[model samples]
Target: MPDFTATTPHIIPLVYQPDSAHWFALVRHLPHAVWLDSGRPQSTYGRFDIIAAAPQCLVETRGANTSIRYDDGRTDESALDPFYLLKKYLPADQLPEHSNSNLPFIGGALGYFAYDLGRRLETMPNLARNDIALPDMSVGIYPWAIIQDHQHKTACLVINTELGQRLGDAYNFLEIEQLCASAAKNPAFHEAINCIKSVQKSFKISEFESNLKVEEYQQALAKIHDYIRAGDCYQVNFAQRFSAEFSGDPLIAYLALRQALPSPFSGFMQLEAGSVLSLSPERFIQVRDKRVETKPIKGTIKRGATPEEDAANAEWLQNSLKNRAENVMIVDLLRNDLSKHCAQVRVPTLCELQTFANVHHLVSTVTGELTPNATALDLLRDAFPGGSITGAPKIRAMEIIEELEPTRRSLYCGSLGYISADGQMDTSIAIRTLVCDGDKIHCWGGGGIVADSETEQEYRESIAKVKVLMDTLEKEFGS
Candidate 1:
């Protein structure tokens, strides 16, 4: 662990405020750069375009992160939790404050969390789907940052006193400004001049193929129904993945996906393990000022073809007993999880209808005040692999998921965000995500399964969740 004890912290300049999309084009070309965008009408944190090719340290776990307990059929040990690895390696840094400052990711780890990492926390009593192969966690350190504040129309560069020695570059304010100015004007990269289109109407639902055939899914859903009836579990969120081997340029696919569905929690991470492209709309957990909040999404309906149709769909979902019931189960699950480290727990909103480019979801917000000694890691450990993804009585639901699904969920349900050096953290539920490893690309979608969940309906719902990402890949590489 390299010491980054900055004697004095300082700020730099990014010159012109580069458009987030075009800037992303430039940043993604670099190594270990992550773009966390919450453009206007922000979702969680304000807009952040920060990268660290020259990290102070890097940590990724292999078979050592998680000790094997009950391996029903899994051969690989769980990799370390990237979030936990980051909290251990990086020193706590409360960023320098300013009236116009927007992002809290001053100097933190920029990486991802793999769904398989859960094996570290609990035993896999059932068989894993073994869907794909990828690292459980990977994070690059960034002791310096250049941020763009879209709301205020300004850009600022932040760094610690270790200054010029970190990246081995003799950098001054003027030089840093010139370097950014150059990146902004690079003619080869098209500038992301306007907002990403909010709606995409070209995709047809019939184009996607399911990992499990119709009859297969129906039989599986029946088994889950049996479990519910037997009092084995109340609700289980069973999910199946949709994937095809693709060799297209990942950046192009990401660009197309973002254009079709612009969102607040969207991110692009280029790591040695693989390329991560996420347009997630769900906020799993956020800790700031010792307060923890989670917004779990349980019920979903496809966005209608027209405005009237869309309104009708939203209205139906809002009032649907099944949808609301599905939502409340997860809310109860999360509330109980947070209670472990929280002094107080409250549900600010219940079964609220929220719209996205491709679908409408029933969401509920859960908030808790941290106990005296609770840290950000504590909040994540207490409530992770979010309740919405796993069903009510989380542990059993997860065990059922492993037995039924065909492959491990590498990153689909895991999170991708920053745990700030200052200790403020925000991460998404890892839905609407794509992982590119070599010539293959993996994506997953599913919904919570309750007593009344229909086999075909649940299958269609899972497909609907991943429709945007699948279509983007199809258009770019589906040929």
Candidate 2:
């Protein structure tokens, strides 16, 4: 277990403007890059953007590498993680954490951990019938990176590989004056350079089809309540999916979605099979300086139009016994999960109602110290498919989810982010995530169900949770 503090990457500061347009133009066409932007001015990570690519290695799998999973419905477990897991691949060195430098991120593996990978950890069946035939997991190790800090208005382009090996006369290529002069000569680059703020180009696409009918969702919610009464599980998070086929640009759709609902964990990635557009607000797990933390969001409510009305709604949410109870359940579950790989597991805070642009969520913060022997893969195995999205009594809740949900979750409830060259990492709970599968797009949302949960209320809550993204998609593709 090596820490990144010992390794230092080649860092070159650039004359970066506080915008994504110019940055988007250069990397939009690059292969295997991750663009994680905190669209919101006020974000948890101080409004940072990271564009990393040029993967030296790629790893994709449906099952846990430690587990022996046969295609013919047979499987075995090894209680270990893949040797090539992101945790192991992070460079031995990292960028300085102090404010003196513009680099907020170190180069590392950037991609996603799909929700279906849960079956590999502990056997909970998956039919593996993917409509898009997308990989269960896709993570790449990018050797080059560009990191920006909006608040400080500074940026840097970092290369992990040597100048002679990867780029000829790399020092000359790393010069800001030379790059600026070259960009000034290009039309698109010049336009982006002059662009002042983030601008989204509107788009239009086809309508969508719901996998679960409104009535079907209500019925399923009621059945979940019945299961609760029968002592099967205390809480279960369930979801409904809406899918549509589109031939337009998904990156443009992602841009519109960001404008509509800017969240801290939102990101966009163009992969071989399709593109992943995410607008998630929940922070599943973040590790920095060798410390582990998880922010589990368990409650949701729509915002009100007036200040008085908004205050009333916030107060109502804070005082809601049902929502508060659900929030604590998942927090406790995460605490338990962290305990396996982390020492001194503790809950720093609980049930803080954080308001977003369109909705409010009861979020709780849990922190711990990762044990000396634990690796990043350990955290993924222990706390993955996030307790907030899955439910308390994690395994049992998943069983119920598998039986009720119509479509395979694919990347919906899974997570996406970076495992830095060192060990520092941050991943979102993959909520409000949209998968662009060829000409078809898929998205899902839902909530925790308790013993006294109301079917109609739960169904409505699920719809409200995803309304922002749905509206963005509709407007982007509206007739």
Candidate 3:
């Protein structure tokens, strides 16, 4: 890694959503910069939801025509290079050799970058044309070394651990007082609200059912059970499908859905012209300082409307023997997966039931120390498509999925996040997600299938998971 000491003074704070037209322009032109898009959908009401892109590399005390020509051809190449562009600006040697499961990044310390930059921006904030809150979505950037997959119409962004650290640190360092006060006065804030109003009426739900025979699905589940019984696999995450046809721009629909229901792992990714709106709540995997962690969510139960009823439902979910068993089975599966990539593997946490506003879930945390030569990419490849999504004996589960599922998953279970120059990476299990290919839009939802799993219950769970997407659209655009 080259020494970044000389360039430290040049680093400054940048706060802009990446999806906005202007912010996109800034990223296209800025050099040695970090671009982030939190995939939060645009809202027609309340605090203007934002899609911002900030040019961190161009912040300086004196203004120099900080603009560069955007080569449309370059966008294809630029989006693919996960590490090539960021490597130029980051100190490679300063990065750690091992990964960290606890901290954000495992390679170098980009957390400091976010920390220093966020603090500086606080002192000298950049003026924006719009008043939009950064989308409260998962944060990561694509590396600039990889080539855009024009065939798949997807781009890869690399995020270094240093950048991850920087973001985490900066998030903690934010001056909430100043931000809140500034938000009150921004005129664009009101404009953002109006935009939400204009589009709110356009939201609608489109529904569809699978062509696969119900008996076939049942047989598939039975096969999965047979595999478990034979010790071929301990647990397998089996899924079924339901899809819908959409008429408007898929990207636009995704944005509206996000505003209606923002999830912790929400993502908005532009894969060529097609985009994905994901509101997943599961963390697939995270690497920091040579340690790895995965939180697998297995069991789920829908929430009730009343507070008391919701609490009762959560309690019931927590006490349910079947839910607990499903959760543990996945936990064991994840432990074995981690064991392949790391040493000292252990399930420090197990079968912890967590309740979200919409549903209650059974979650467990597994951890391990990374082996030497383990890169963030290597971790993802070894554990591509998390265990919770894929049942135990992942390979067989996937094969069964291909046969049972009617359409390509596309970004349904695929990840969207940045891998930094320092090798820090975080990705979500693409659940509660919508994939838009032009006017056609499809969203997916399913749950783990175990030996004792009931067909009707599983069917309901799948629909329950996607209710937010359904309701958001109907409420916003009308049925």
Task: Highest lDDT: give the candidate number.
Answer: 2
List model 3 lDDT by residue over 1-479, tens digit each: 24331111112122333233223322322222221233333321111112222222211111211121122211212222222334434433433664332223212211101111111112322331111111112122321221122223232222232442332223211332233234436666435534544654444556555534668666766776777677666556655455555554343465566555555556554433344666666777776666778888888989888989888988888888888887887787778878887888888877777665478888788888777756555666556667787676666666556555544454566564444445565666777876555545666777777777777777678778887786666555444
lDDT of 2: 0.73
Question: Which scores higher on TM-score, 1 or 3?
Answer: 1
How much lDDT does candidate 1 score? 0.68
Root-mean-square deviation (CA) per prediction = 6.4, 5.6, 13.3
Ranking by lDDT: 2, 1, 3
Task: Encode model 2's per-residue lDDT on 1-479: one tens digit a residue.
Answer: 24333235677676575555467556566566578877745444437778765455566775544433221333444434443344445533332232222354556667888888777667887642457556677877665677777877877777665411331223222443345446646667847523322333334567767898877887888889888988889899999898887775677787667778888888888887798999889888887665789999987888989998888989998999999999999988999989888888888888998888888888999998877756555676677789988886889999999888877888998998887655567888899899988778888878899987778878788888888788777765664
RMSD of 2: 5.6
Which whole-number lDDT from 0 to 100 does residue 26 have in model 1? 47
Candidate 1 TM-score over all chains jointly: 0.84
Error of 1 at 106 (Å): 1.1
**Candidate 1: deviation at residue 242, Å?**
1.3
What range of 10 consecutive residues in model 1 has the weakest lDDT sum?
67-76
State the weakest 10-residue window (summed lDDT) of model 3. Answer: 109-118
How many clashes in each structure?
10, 6, 60
